[model samples]
Structure formats: C-alpha cells, structure tokens
Target: MIEEPGRVVAIEREAVWIEALDEAACPGCTASVGCGRWSFDWLETPRRRRRIRALSVMPLRVGDAVVVGIREDFLLRSTLAIYLLPLLGLFVCTIAIQQLGFGESLMIPAGFLGFVSVWAMVRRISRRQMNDPTLQPVVLRALPGASEGQVRQAAF
Candidate 1:
C-alpha cells in the first residue's frame, strides 16, 4: 500500500472528498528544458490536487487529515489497461486486417485506421474506468490521532 497524505476538503454522509498534496522533485541536469516533455510536466506540476471520494470509514470533519492508500495491483492493472491494451489492440487489428483479402494499398490504410479506432476505444474505456469508485484506489486507513490543525499542515 502506497500511502499519500491528503486533506479532507469535504465530508458528506457517505463519502469523503480529498485533495492530495503535491510532491516536487528537481530533474537534475538532464537538459530536458525546451523539450515537449519538460513543458508538459511544467504545465501539470502546479495542478496537483486529486479530488477523490472515499468510503466513509469514520465521522471525518472537513479539515481532517487522512491517508489514502493506492494498492500496487490497482496501479499495475490501470497502467496495463491504459498503455499496453492500446498497443495490443493495434497489433491485433493490424494482423486481422492483413488476413482479409484486400489489396496492399487498402490493407495498409485500413489497418492504420483500425489501429487508431481501437486506440480511441481503449482511451474511452480507460476514462470510464478511472471514474469508477471501485476502480479508484482504496483508503486502507486514516490517522484519527492527528489534530485538525496538524492534518491541515501535514506533508504528503
């Protein structure tokens, strides 16, 4: 279980909403600057609040400090579904298109298009999966010992 410290932004009868704290790391002298990768990371680094609804385990107040656990298996499964499935779909679709009795020109374009279609479908499925409460990482435990003030200032 990978635990992340978060603040309880809102508390309802059935669920608790939490915004995760951001952890920063300096990318050492890798000359990643000016690259698209660097720019993307820079854009996303500041927006790190992850709004999550968790099962109401205890009577959590709005400023409570809680620990959210992301199970390893859940992360692995999510990564595979999002990244590998799309590549696998592309490969399977390409092979299937090749076996169909079409001219090379049509086969190539059709296979490419089919791969794109499957990739799009996989992306859609991933989005839906992420929104599922069951699929969202579980809250294994919460530290009720911490004071409300401490919870607010706790580091992730």
Candidate 2:
C-alpha cells in the first residue's frame, strides 16, 4: 500500500479530512547538494496544506494523522473516464462528420478541430480533477509516533 502521513484537519461522522504534510526537500533527490543543482531547491519547498478526504476507518480527532490514495480499481476507472472518453468522442464525431456528405475542405478541418477540442477539454478536466483533493482515496493511517514536523523538515 502506498501510504503517506497526513494530519486530520476535520473529523465528521462518516468521513475524515486529512492534510498531507509537504516535504521541505525534494524526496526525488539522491544527492547531498554537492551538485550544481542547488538552485532548484527553491522549487522543492513544501506548501502549507493539502487536504484529502477518506472514509472514517477509525475514530479520529482533529489534528490526528492519516494517509490517502485511491484503490487500484478506482484509479484505473478514473484514468479511463478521463482519457478514453474524450478519444472516443473525437472518433465518433469525426466519423459522423465524414458521413454527413460535407466537402473534404470543410469536413477535414472540422473533424480535426473537433478532435483537438476534445483533447484540450480532456486535459483541462484532468487538471481540474487533479486539483480536487477529495478525489483521492485514503489508503492507510499513520501511527501515533508520526510527526508532521519531521515530515516537513528539509533534508538539504
């Protein structure tokens, strides 16, 4: 299970809202800042809060810790809906436009533009969905020893 520590920002009867602690240092880095890439460290600074929603598995209070991520099936379904639906719409629209007896000059450009528009819309929707923290699933809960300060401490 891919798990990350987060603090409970809100607690409801059926759901819990947790905010993931941002890492101060780039977790992707392997170096000790000996390289010339220290200039990029500014980009690695953590944000203040990232709210996530989860089904309440345990009685959690405000300021508790939790982890969030989608199940594999849910992730797959989300990807297909976000990606394949637009492509299918593009394909169907193109075919319908071609069969409508419009001239190639008009039909081709319209079809191409339709496909592009669908692709652009998919991208926009995907970005918007990614911005919604509630879409993500809560997969695990952190132990009582987990410290938000430790998670936010910069390694560089």
Candidate 3:
C-alpha cells in the first residue's frame, strides 16, 4: 500500500476531494552540498497538485486533513492496461498483415487500426472494473491538528 497526507478540499456524501503536493523524489546527486542544483530544480520544476476523490471512513469537512491509501497493484494494472496492449496490437497486426504479402500502405493502416482497437478494448475492460474494491482509494484516518498549539503539543 502507498499512502499520502492531503488536505480535504471538499466533501460530497462519502467522497472527499484531496489535493496532495507532488514532491520531487530526489533533489540532488552525490556531488552537491551547496551547488547550482537548488536554483535549477526550482525554475525547471513547477508546483504540482494532484487531486483525487477518496471514499472516507469517517465524516469529513472542507479544510480537514487526512491520510489516503491505495494498493500498489492498482498502479501496475492501470499502466499495463493503458500501454502494453496497444503496443502488442501494433506488432501482431502489422506482422500478420505483412505475412500475407500486403504492401506497406496496407500494413501501416492496419497497424494503426489495431492500436486503436486494442486501446478501446482496454478502456472497456477497465471501465467494467470501475467498482472493483482494489482500485478505489480510501481515507484511512483524520490528521490530528490544523493549528499551531495542537500540532506542537502532539509533536512532544
């Protein structure tokens, strides 16, 4: 499971919108203690906000902070469904068409068609799985404090 803390932006019944910052996983290589990397990283990188809705186990309000989690397999499965099938479709269709002595013109169109067809098929299969429990992220618990004193007390 992968989890992150986010601030809840809105609530609608069981669903809450959470906005999480997408931080760069690495800031520097081994060489730099005080180098140009900090300024380079700053200008090249933009503020990234990733927002998603999660089913909450507890009642939530706007401005509340919470922990959200999703299974690792969800990421793997989604990537394969979106990318791998289309690439395989192009190879299979193009090769099969060429084996029949079709010209490049026919093979190219056929491969493009194969890519679109496979992409559509993957979309349909994934849509049918929209209600699958493993794919849905959920809010695990609320954060303890939103203000200064409560946060300081909890830190001790």
lDDT of 1 by residue, 26-97 (tens): 324366675565667677866466687776667778777787767778888777866787667666766776
Model 3: residues with Cα > 4 Å off, grouped in runs: 25-45, 146-156
Q: Write the per-residue lDDT of candidate 2 for residues 1-156, one digit (tens) a residue.
A: 345667788876667887875543356677737645555545666455667777666777887655655666657767787778767767777777778877767766676777778778878877887646456566365545457665333212
TM-score of each: 0.65, 0.59, 0.76
Cα lDDT of model 3 overall? 0.76
Comparing candidate 1 with candidate 2, which one achieves the higher TM-score?
Answer: 1
| Ranking of all candidate structures by their TM-score, best first | 3, 1, 2
- Which has the higher TM-score value, candidate number 1 or candidate number 3? 3
Q: Give the clashing pairs for model 1.
A: none
What TM-score does candidate 1 get on C-alpha atoms? 0.65
1-156, model 3: which lDDT tens digit per residue?
677667798887778998865544332345544555445656654656789888876878888877788888887888987999999998889999999999999999999989999999999998898877658888877876655334222222
lDDT of 2 at 95: 77
Off by over 4 Å in 2: 22-26, 29-48, 104-136, 149-156
Residue 75 displacement in candidate 2 (angstroms): 1.0
